[model samples]
Target: MSLQFHNQLTHRVDTFTPQIEGKVSLYTCGPTVYNYLHVGNWTAYIYWDTLIRVLQANGLRVERVMNITDVGHLVSDADEGEDKLEKGARREGKTAWDIASFYTDDFIKGMARLHLLTPQHIIKATSYITEQLELVRTLQKKGFTYQIDDGIYFDTSKFPSYGHFAGLDLDAQKAGARVEFNPQKKNPVDFALWKFTPQGETRDMEWETPIDLLEPIVADGLEYEQANKKMGFPGWHLECSAMAMTLLGKTLDIHTGGIDHIPVHHTNEIAQSEAATGVTFAHYWLHNNHLKVNGTKISKSLGNGYTLNGLGEKGYSPLDFRLFVLQRHYRSEGNFTFENLESAKNRLHNWRNSAALRHQTHDRLRDDDEKSTDDESVSLYASSQALIEAISNDLDTPAACAIIDEAFRKIDGINLEDIHQHALTSFIETVDNLLGLALFDTSKDISDDIKRLIIERERAREKKDWQAADRLRDQIEKSGVTVRDTAHGSIWEYVA
Candidate 1:
């Protein structure tokens, strides 16, 4: 089946067609890197990682870029507040550069724990100031930019289709803003492309604003402070366009972020980039819906923004949260609770147990006279193909998960002697490849000593010697393996 995705730009599910056949250029909005990411923030990353996996599974070579916003992201997500990195520095009593480095390292560690695929390029916004400034200069030359007292701004009035992507009503926005809007801005929707540092204050992450990019009025007027060496920074929306174009090209196959970006951040990116390049910024746009905690919005004041470390303290691994996120469709809003997370944890535990069956499948089949069993035996090969089909259809991860559950249920019903070891191992590989749950890494055969103890325990149970059976079970538990005596036989699992 062909790939399909619900394109936010078109407001419909469109079949995917890369600009170049068999090659995809993708961009994902990354973390701001001022603090540890909450589970809500990690949801987008996991989903996009699955997108990369599915693209590869469909024989497409993906050249992806993810940015780390170390500078210029404001507290308000607009141009009106303090930069997040500088705010983080004040909170932690460290330099803005140091705060970015520390949190960026933490984000990478979290990605490893979650088993996410790394992008081909992980560029930091601070590293590309010159490129960002060049983009602003291009806009300035194209007459799409104007200067106000605070910064250089993009004129939404110049872009006729500025609000088309989000279906925004500019006239209504202007009417709503009559009471408390920036008096200097020409339109209510005009956004900053670059912001100048206030005259009396210095920023930890400022760069010299190019004199040529500044307006003649601002550069020549004596009222402007520090005009010869003005320090400023790129707007939050500017870096993504600049970095994506610099690495990928003028156009991209896919661009992904949270739904909140559509109205402001992404809309502004489209206006500025297409205005500068005279082409569509991205062919397809994918936005994941927000993740709520306990049916409430995740807020700092609520203290409900649980980080990976916080979940670890509660004995939930990153993979458990990953599975929880995948259970819901990406376009649907997800409500997260500890209770819901526990269910996903148990589900992963069961999957690992099923994966452990591969090791025992060979042993059980070796004793049978025929190497293969009945014609009705389960075919994981067909299941693997079905799994890809579900994912290819707009990243239907929930459906794909249901398919896995059904396949595992079939394996559970059949006798162990009938399970094909090679097919089962291949299925496990597909699961790890598509879902990144790391089943193969987590599930393994028990030590031979533990296996012998299980044999003795089985013998004792066959003879109805309950005390000896109990003793052997205790010995097996000491080695961190638990035994479940089903009617079929004894099954061993790790105690994690």
Candidate 2:
């Protein structure tokens, strides 16, 4: 079966046929290193993670790249807001670079805890300064850029398809009628390529450009006194365009980000990239819906979102939240609440306990000499085969989740020795490889001592020592291993 996805570019939901056979190249806009990543940011990543897992499970080799926007991202998509990194610096009392370094490490650690597979390539915008300048030069030479009081601006009016992805009327875009219209822009939709550092201002993070220090030339719908030669910064949109060109070449297979990116950030990327390359920028465009809480967005400024450290301190395992995210599709917005998270946790614990039960049943078979595989092994094998079918069908994750849940519930019904072995092994290996659930990792394997305690707990239950068994389970859990009780046996997993 072939993979399928809803392509925003064509406005059609179609099968995901890659440009190259058996290999998929994808680029997701990663979080800007402004502060610790909030749960909202994580939902996007988790969505992408599921997509990658589903693709890999369908036997498609994926080459994924996620960009780290350490610089050139503004608090406002209108290109008139404060730099997010600079804001982080002000909040942390450190340099922008330091903040980027600090939080990037934190983000990586969070993903590790969640068992999210890292991208094949991580491109940082700050590191691509030379590349950014060259791309701007390319646009300049191509007659796509014009000098404005604010620095170089990409003349969105020049591109007939300026609002191509945005599905906005070109006339409405040019009329200064949109939100946050700057009176000084020649066209309301024109966006900054490079910002000339404001004159006479000592910016801690200014770069000297090779452009001439000249007097201001043009004015706009509304303007005041400002020179184009003053040192500023690179505008947000140009950074992604330049970085995407450098890493994925002039064209990309797919470009992904939050739905919020569709109107401005991604719109400008298409303008600049296609203007320079004279071709379509990306074949498919995928956007993840927001992870909203209480019908509003989660942002650091609002103090409404949770970071990994914050969630971890509250005793929520990172993967539990990751599993929570998988309950919905990438294009679907997921609700956030303590109730939902608790429900997801229970589901994960129950699944683990079922696996443990299967393992114990296998052990009993080994001892009985009648020779049969456990219920889990059989159920997993059946589920693994269905996993591919679900994933290939536009990554039907919710369906796959249901199938997995059913397998967990029906493990007891599977009893054939040879059949059970084949099914269980197949299920654990294939679905694990696809979902990135870390079910069979050597490092994640439970220690023997904890396993022994878990088995003892099981035996205690068998002996009808209910209180003692519960106490033993608690003790084992307090030792940093989580215990899950199943019909077949008790199982434990190490917590980080």
Candidate 3:
């Protein structure tokens, strides 16, 4: 089956065909780098990672771009609150620059721990200020932007397709305006492209506005003029549009983000991007559903947010969390609990053990010159085909995982002598590439001390010295290694 994705733009599962043949331009919204990324934040990355793997598995060269929003993400979607980075800085008693640097590193480390592939281009919003300003200038010249007391705002009324992606009711929104109803705004739905710095207040991160871009405005029967040299920052939605277009191009094959961005953030991106360039912004739009905990949204305000280190403190590896995420489809809402996480942990452990046993059996039996019979080859081919079919169908990860479970059961039933080493190796590598699980890793070099201890423990076991064997086992475990006594011999692995 060919790969398909549920494009949020069309609200349909469409077959994916890149704009350029043999190459796919993909972009995913990265973290704001204001604080440590919680599990909820990680879920979006996992979904995008799976998408990238699926695309590459289909033999399409992918040029993926993810942005690190170091600045310009306001606390509220209305773009009326403090910058998230600046808020974080105030909360942590650090400079905004320090906060961004620290959190960006932390986010990258968490991604590495979860085995997420780094994108081809990871651009920071602060690094692309020139591009963002240029984009704002383009919108102003195109007569799609208006200036207010706060900053430059996009005139959503001018863009006929405003809120088309989200199905927003412009008249209804104006009637039932709940918050951030700026009276100076020509329309309540209009959003800021750049925000002016507050009077008599200095900001650590602000850029001087271009003198020639100011336009006159009339408010409350009085003529007002925009500050030509005002210091301000870009808006949250502006950064994504600028960075994505700067790196990927005017149009992208796929644009991905959390479902929460569907309403205002992504809608504004479409309005401004299409308004500036008289073409479609992206071919496909994909969003992952929210990750909840204890029946509530995982947020810092709710005190339900969790980080990777928090999981480790509770005795769960990052891959265990990854497994938990994959057990459910990305488009479905997943509720996380310790019980569910434990189940995923146990599943991962069993799968890893089975894979190790298969490797050991393959090493013990097949000779270098031996080849598999027709039956073995057929079994391997069937298992591989099942996995491919499962993953290719809209990234049905839960189905793919079930196929893995079935493959392991089949492996357990087959005799080691009948399995072909080359075929088994190829199958295992393909599975790893598709799943992003380090299942076939056996590259750890055991130290001489641990090896000698294992040997002594084996001798003690053979001599019926249970007490000495138990003591040696404890010592080996204290050295951060786990030992399992099998019928063939004892196997040791590092404690993750």
Candidate 4:
């Protein structure tokens, strides 16, 4: 089956055809690195990881680029307020550069813990100031930019398809007196491309632009005077367009982010990029729905936000959280709760145990007999194909997980002696590859103390001493090994 993605630009689930055959050029918006990433932020990365895995599963090479917004991203998406990094520095009592580095390291660690594939190119917004300035210059030269007292602004009226990607009704939005318009802005929807540093205020992240003066060109009743070598910073929307085109060519095969970005951030990107290049900014725009908690958006302001460390403190492995994310469809909103996470934890525990049992059974069979059959290979291939088909249809991870569940049921229902061990192993490994669950690495050697506790727990269970068994189980868990009692015996594994 051909892969399909629901492109936000076209508002349809279109078949994916790469700009270049057998390869994909993908870009995903990275975090602002102002603070610890909450689970809501991580959801976008999880879905993007699944997309990359699915693409690679279909034998396509993916060159993915993700950016770290260390500078220029403001507290308000509307191009007003302090830079987020500077705000974070004030809150934490550190330099803006230090804050960016520290939080970026934390973000990377979180992604690694979640088993997310790191992008091939991880660029920082601060590292590409030259490119950003050049992009602003290009827009200025094209007569698409105008100057105001605050900064260089992109004239939305000049871009005919300004709001096409977001399906924004520009006329109605302009007519409605919903938002306070900037007096210097010609159109209500005009956005900043460059922001001039406040007079007599020194900023840690501001830079001197090459442009000698902000031209005194007047357009739409807005006038400005030239200031030689004005110190300013790039706008939030300009960073992505500059960096993406610098690394991934003028057009990208896929550009993904949270659905929240569709309205402002991504809309501006499309406007500035297409206006400059006169071509499509990206071939496909993929967005994942937000992650919510308790029927509300997961946010720090709500006090419902959680970091990976916070989840770890609650005794949940990162992969358990990853499983929780995968059990739901990316396009659908997922309500996060500890109860749901516990359910996913148990499910993953059971799945890992089943895979471990299969591995043990396969080992025993291999020792006894080395014979294989062509029918077994055919069956394994068919099972793999079914799994791929499930994921390929717009990344239906829930359906793919259901297929794995069915496979496990089939393995359990059939006779162990009659089962082809190699095929079963191959099928399980392939599923793990696609899902990135790390189920096959279940042979983690338990410490001798944990082994002794497991023995005591087993004895307590044999004696029908429920209280003692429960106590030993608690002790085992405190030692960082999860204990699962099986019909055969008690099983233990490290807590990730």
Candidate 5:
């Protein structure tokens, strides 16, 4: 089957076709780098990473760009709070640039620990300031931008389809607007493209607001204090559009982010970008749902925003957490609890043991035996193909995982010598490539000394020396290898 995804733009599961055949241009909304990312913040990244893997598995060359919002992203989506980086600086007693640098490094390290594929171009929003200004200029030239006291704002009224993508009720938003709303805005749903620094206060991150963008301002909102070069910065929505179009082109094959971005952030991206280029900003938009903690929304006030380090502190590796994330579909809201995580950890442990079987069976299947395939041989080969197909159908990770579980169940029932060595190895490789679980790396062969101990234990068991066999089993486990004495034979598994 061809690749498919629930395209949020179309609001349906659509077949994925790239703008250019065999080449996919993907843009994923990256972290704001204000602090260490919590599990809730990381779900989108992991989901998008899976999308990249699935695309490559389908034989498509994916050129992906992810944005690091080192600047312009505000504490509030309403564009009324401090820049997240600046706030992080104040909280950590560092400069905004220093905060961005530190958190960006932490984010990258976390991605590595989770085995996420690095995007081809991970651009920082600060690096594309000039490009962002050019986009604002384009919007201004097209008569799609207006200036207020705060900054340059997109004229949502001019773009009649502004709320169409998000299905936003502009009339309701305007009618229910609070009295404290910014009356200077032309429309209640209008968003900032650039934000000016408040008067009498300097900021750690600010840029010059071009004079041309300041002209044609509102009658009551025109005030320039810096010799026609007011200090400002790009809006949170502006950076993604600028960086995405500048790197990926005017249109993208796929754009992905959390579901929360639909109403404000992504809708504005569509508005400002399409108004500038007169074309669809992205062909497909994919959104992953939120992750909650113990059935509550992840919140710092609730102290449920668990970071990767937090999970590591509790003795769960990043891969274990990755398996936890993939246990449910990406579009499904996941509930995070230690109990749930323990289940994923155990599942991963079982898969690692199954992965170890390949090391035992390698180089043992005869050529003649390969010609006469057994049920186990066909099962392993078919399981690998089924995994790809399941993931291709809108990234059905849970289904793909179930397929592996079924194949491993069969492998568990049969004799180790009867296993198909070549098919088993290919199946493990497929699991690693598609899931990024690094099963092979974790399931290495035991040392020669440990192998000898296992042999001694087997000999003791054959002679019915129960005491001696128990002693040898203890010795084998000391080396982090535990032997499972099955009816077929003993299988070695990693202890932790």
Candidate 6:
């Protein structure tokens, strides 16, 4: 199967082949772990989930690593603000570590509800301080790092291709409206790899660098710092560069984040990573556009960001939001409206109810006599093959899902013969086996039992006897699998 997805770097859809055969490694920027993830941000998660599902559908082994920035992320992208965790601590009246841990747990719980497969590894910035410092040391040794009074900075000019990933020109980022130009910086685009704290402040998470160890820094907040005192942690951009390089290598098969992250955040990562390793940062850079409300981008400071909890307060499930996300291509910004959600929820409910009906019909066919298990198996095998074909094609889930509806309708109009009915049972079994979206209790042995019936139907169909196949197909549909007849054979699958 060939999968074609849009690559932001190339600005076009390209064929996807893994960097290595049968294996792909992906690194996505994870939440900053400072607050509940706003839904706009959660689109990145869902977009990646769909991609991962498609990868699995194509039979590739995927290894994914998403980082947790519990520490080292400053409130401002320019490295001019307080550490975000510390800022959150002040807001919540807790320790910095407490804030980080609290939000990290919250993010994990949200992923559980969203049905996202957990990343193979979840690394945290705080857990890898030594590794981060080592990266700083490497860059410094390689002449890619320059130091200001507060902390070390990565020289973006050291690598000329710094801002291209974000569709940004180098000079534009240096002078962009959102950027802050520091006088101490050698270049306007240089970003901190480390930061010095104002003198005398009690930093709950401060660490001593080689410079700090060498100087007897005075502890006075009003005195202000030209050197490290109580300043805590690395800058956000540098943390990603260091962590991503450490865990997934300097280059990755894919790098994913939101459109918001493109400019300063991901741009800096690309700059620092490539400068540090002198290699490409990522082969494919994918970014999902934002979700908007009434044509404005949804955000928290504007009092417009809604979480899954906030949406549910009005009696909507997170699944409703998930379905809403599915309605649009990931590249396009989707508008969120209560009216839109209502329509989607109605359609979702209709699909499930209709699919379930189709499956119930597949139940009756297993009782066929002379239902040689072989006939049942063949019928099922043929049906599932077709269903799998629909899903594996660029994750055309809507098409694959629609096929279920069509199959149910077709099976509803059929009567049973041994072979035809058996063939129908087999198709039902096939759809269930491949998609894992059937409405049955998968933990129960019902799937196995259904597969056995399908084999009998397949054998019946092979004999060129329509009566037994049709009978078994009807029986299987009665069992809750929808069956359809084709010129080639009979097929069946779960209704919902």
Collision count for each candidate, in order = 0, 10, 0, 0, 0, 67
Evaluate residue 268 in candidate 2 and report its C-alpha lDDT on the 0 to 100 scale: 90
- Residue 83, candidate 1: alpha-carbon lDDT: 94
Which candidate order results from sorting by TM-score in descending order? 5, 1, 3, 4, 2, 6
Task: Give the better candidate number (3 or 5) by lDDT.
Answer: 5
Residue 176's lDDT within candidate 2 is 45
TM value for model 3 = 0.88
Q: Assess the local accuracy of residue 341 in candidate 1 as a C-alpha lDDT between 0 and 100.
A: 97
lDDT of 6 at 463: 91
Considering lDDT, which of the candidate structures 2 and 4 is the better prediction for this target?
A: 4
* Per-prediction TM-score: 0.96, 0.85, 0.88, 0.87, 0.96, 0.75
lDDT of model 5 at residue 384?
94
What RMSD, rounded to one decimal, does every model reach?
2.2, 5.1, 4.0, 5.1, 2.5, 8.4
Off by over 4 Å in 2: 173-181, 212-230, 300-302, 363-379, 413-419, 441-496
Instruction: At residue 459, give the lDDT of candidate 1.
Output: 98
CA lDDT, every model vs. true structure: 0.91, 0.74, 0.84, 0.84, 0.90, 0.69
Q: What would the per-residue lDDT of candidate 6 be over residues 1-496, giving only the tens digit for each residue?
A: 6777677778887778777888877888899888888778787788787777667767888788889988767766567677788899999999988998999999999887776778898888887777777777777878887766677788877777777776666666456645444778877667888776666677767676655222345656545354333344677787777777777777788888888788788888877777778888888877887899767877657787888898889777666677677666677778888888777666555444433333333334445454543454354455456566654554455565566556544444333333344455455454444433332322122366676777778888789677987787777777777555556444454444
Q: Which consecutive 10 residues in model 2 have the weakest lDDT in total?
A: 412-421
In candidate 5, the residue pairs with backbone N, CA or C atoms under 3 Å apart (3 or more residues apart, or in different chains) clash, namely none
Of the pair 2 and 6, which is ahead by lDDT? 2
Model 3: residue 29 alpha-carbon error in angstroms: 0.6
Which ten-residue region of model 6 has the weakest summed lDDT?
437-446
lDDT of 1 by residue, 1-496 (tens): 6999999989999999999999999999999999989999999999999999999999999999999999999998877788999999999999999999999999999999999999999999999999999999999889999888789999999999999999999999988996655789989889999999988789999998887887654556565545556679999999999999999999999999999999999999999999999999999999999999999999999999999999999999999999999999999999999999999999999899889988877634445544455332346888889999999999999998998888788877456777778778888899899999999999978888999999999999999999999999999999988888876888787776
Q: Give lDDT for model 3.
A: 0.84
Off by over 4 Å in 5: 178-180, 216-226, 363-373
